[model samples]
Target: MLANRVSKRLLVGLQPVFKTPHVLPSSYLSAQNARKFSISSKCYQEQSPEPSDGESSASKKKDEGSRYYVPSSQKRKPLSRVTIGSSTDNARFRRASDTIEFSSWKAGILFVTLGTGLYFFFRYQKEKMDLQRNEESNRGYGKPLIGGPFNLIDQDGNPFSSDNLLNKFSLVYFGFTHCPDICPDELDKMSACLDILKSKYNIDIQPIFITCDPARDSPEILKEYLYEFHKDIIGLTGPYEDIKNICKAYRVYFSTPPDLKPGQDYLVDHSIYFYLMDKDGEFIDALGRNYTEETMAEHIKNHVDAFVSKEIREKRKQGWFSFLY
Candidate 1:
């Protein structure tokens, strides 16, 4: 009875400690006994939902994390603003290029349109002028000479023209002294013909040798080359255009090498005919390349005498001494 009373007294005394406002140890305290209870309770709490009663902190944290995780463009890590900014930069560049292209295209179209308009306008005016010119030309007679004013350089590097041959007839031949087969042979035949003309009728005439190969025949080159031929034969050379025009004027045929490759030498094939020009520089006769000095003179003297009176022909034909007259 006494033991029961003491035990009862101990239990009643412990109830005061248990029921009173005693300070509880923190959950982090890991006494050997406390650690066992903490592990078991932590696992249990993880399995169970955390209490939402009273405290909003847990819910606030969950809301914050979820906000960051929410997908903007289908859960991509990159943000919508970042994607938009990159896309915007690309779009801006494209827009700038497009603007430049549009402006350039617009300018081109405007220029082309303006040019077309002007071209048609000038063309219409030209047609009207041509019609009036045709009517006026029809009122007048005579076939106009088919030729344009040509600029050319002569034997002495001076400009020679029909004016240079004024008061004198010209014997224009396309030949080069270096030409082994045709040029020298043809020139010799011409010289023989001229000699025959000298016997029958001596005329103050000019024979010109134009080079086919300018690379080998400048003014200096031609001067030395003509020494092999008749002393009276004048040599001529110039730039390509001058040579081309001179040849064209006399209907002399000459062509360039298809490709003028550097460091390669090529030959030219040209007409072998000699041209006879009147005192006015009009094309008169084309002599055969096969003519000898006798035959050539035979053809020339008659024409020279035909153009002038007998007295004038006699006086002019006395060449080299006619100046004495």
Candidate 2:
């Protein structure tokens, strides 16, 4: 009975050991699961902390503020700073524009000045060329072919020569006092021309009347006849040979009826022209019937204005265009 009680006690102890193994395994698994759950809960609480009532509302407000916040780099600048920078840029732009405008204005002025200068220069050159052409056309080679020395007697019976024509402009008209109507009309026209030239241009010209019919036109008769036309007129009459020579020198053509008797009433046809001579007794031009008194005066005035002194003309002859001169 002692041996049976020892075995039964031994079996009871072994059975308890076997049951403890199963219970220990179940409890260990439960403890492990509980530890894992607690660790997960702690980690979750750390990651997302639960807030109290007041803290929760404050946190929500902070989150909302962060959602709408803008970085400092993207923020708008202050009004005063922006205005100052804008004004600086505007000033730079204005300065650039002013510089361009000034440059354009200066260029325009220069261009206009150059163009005007060129225009006047060309005009002056053209006028000079025209004057040269007129002078060349009027002059002959060497001395003039129309004027020369002559001796004659005036209406006062005083001696006169070609030297008397020097130092002044002279008009020589070859006609007779007994010329029916042509001589008187031509003298009247010449007188009118002289008056116009003197009154308008302040120019004085010597008037002379050389008689082609010296036999009929004596000194006294010639003087009286010329007084009716112009008081300043000087009548000239010489011997037949001298009158013929003077007429030939002046290129005047006159003809009386063939076989005409002396002191007979007959008409003498002569050239009707006023010969214009310069200050040096050089033949300048001839005025024909085609020229009116006013037109004649204007023509003479143009010649006077363009007149150059003999010394100046000689000096110009020595210039680069001496051949042309």
Candidate 3:
């Protein structure tokens, strides 16, 4: 019975020490035991204090981390403002992209312009060189080096000289009547060009064929051979030395073929070119084998037209001066 009472007192004392809000069963504790429990409760209450709001928040941050935390003063921008900022940035990017493309286009145009300029520049230089060559050909070795005084027998056995070239534009060819292919072809082209010039441009050019092989090409032979060719062409033949001097003076190269036998008829190798001579026996131009009859006629027409225009201008100027006087 005493042991039961002591156990009851121990339970009641522990209730006060625990400070539980629930009501305890009736019990009685010894004074010493109750005093000891009260002292232990007071010491525990003094040692452990309530935590502040700051300390609690710090502990929460340590446990859950700062990722979920948001400051009270900071707030999100509205949807409209965010959208406007993004749109402005996109517009700037587009403008930058367009500017780059425009610059690239301008650079490409500049490159093409430079390339075209270079192409035209080179073409102009090439045309200038061709013009210089034509000028040189027109001038010959110098002023009037090709045509000069030469007394030779024509196809009619009449004497012909540089005087015959006065007041008439002449087309001269140096070849042998015995030339199988080259001379015939060139003479035919000359005849065709002459017809075209006369009919189309009213330029009646006199044609002349001077023989390089005078040994075989007598005046009678030349007349007979030229009969089958153009009627207007006059054939000229002379002594070997005279013909040689004429050829040298005109810069016409001619040589006997290497395969010539002592008695066999051989061909004459000669430089082929149609010499266009103005009045007064001045060389105007030399047309090469590459020129067609039509091309030659056209070239002659251009020169004749230029000459006629120049004559008209000079006449007008002279008339004005005479009137003034």
Candidate 4:
């Protein structure tokens, strides 16, 4: 066998003075002594040549299958694998993070809801106080005045003469069925305001819509138009001269375009206003434009509250409460 002087030599302890027989000598000893003894590494400093510049154990490992190596049959230990989580475990962690994000997102919505609730609460309370002030301060009609009145017809097609509507609070306006937009919109507002009045404040005020365009808004037209807006609204269309006199009495100005074609697009120029009257058929205050539905309803509700209180006072004086039996 060739000597392995080119490789790094393993250290051997030469007990220079031997006490045990299984001891080893220096690497210079013959191969016969290499396997003949076991040595304690603590007792020796191996003698090696000055190593070449790049020669390393790794480079020496590349010398496998050279004339020096003797392969061993021992297998290396298998690597240890420590698993952390299953696939579902990762998914559940992601879901938990999503749930936290969702909770934070909905927290903003809850804050907005609470802020809106507080705003409404303050606005509602302010409106209530204003309504009370109006009911107490304005003794007649509790709204602005816009027009006077004349003889008219009721919803039963009966004459809604001044004598009939005089003993109650009245809201009056003038428009015709042939009006393109303004009439229907005004009447609808009045109806919507009244519906809110009845439901929210139990006001039962009378409303009248007298036709300025009597040529097209006949009693039948008036009836159908009234039905389209509100059941309680009374409509009237009488003789042209009489209606003109009524218009003059209420100070309502209306005129039709001169060159209108048959069933053509036409409009009636009239003052848009609300005329509020007292229980004595007498014109009082009125409300002009720019007031919203709730504000208008508030005005009427205040008037009705005053009117009802007066009625109750009078009835109490007459001992009417005893009739509950």
Task: Give the Cα lDDT of each candidate.
Answer: 0.58, 0.73, 0.70, 0.61
Ranking of models by TM-score: 2, 3, 4, 1
Q: Which ten residues in a row have the lowest lDDT in candidate 3?
A: 76-85
Off by over 4 Å in 2: 1-137, 321-325
TM-score of 4: 0.48
Pairs in steric clash, model 3: none
**Residue 79 lDDT, candidate 4, scale 0-100:** 14
The collision pairs in model 4 are 144-285, 144-286, 145-285, 145-286, 152-160
TM-score of each: 0.47, 0.62, 0.52, 0.48
* Ten residues in sequence with the least summed lDDT for candidate 1: 76-85
Model 3, 1-325: lDDT tens per residue?
Answer: 3444444466454432432213322232233235434443443355436433433433333343223323465332211211222445344334445442533778689889999999999996665545534543565553556767788999999999978987888899999988989889988899899889988878899899999999899999999998788999999998889898889878999997676667788888888998877665667688889999999999876655444222443475489564421
TM-score of 3: 0.52
**Model 2 Cα lDDT, one tens digit per residue, 1-325:** 3444444466454431232223344544454345434433444355547534533433343333223333476443321211222445344334445442533778689889999999999997666556655654555568666767889999999988999998898999999988888889899999999999999999999999999988788999999999999988989999999988888888899877888776678877899999888787877788898998899999888777766656677788888887654
Who is ahead in TM-score, 2 or 3?
Answer: 2
- Give candidate 3's error at residue 31 in angstroms: 99
Worst 10 residues of 2 by lDDT: 76-85
TM-score of 1: 0.47
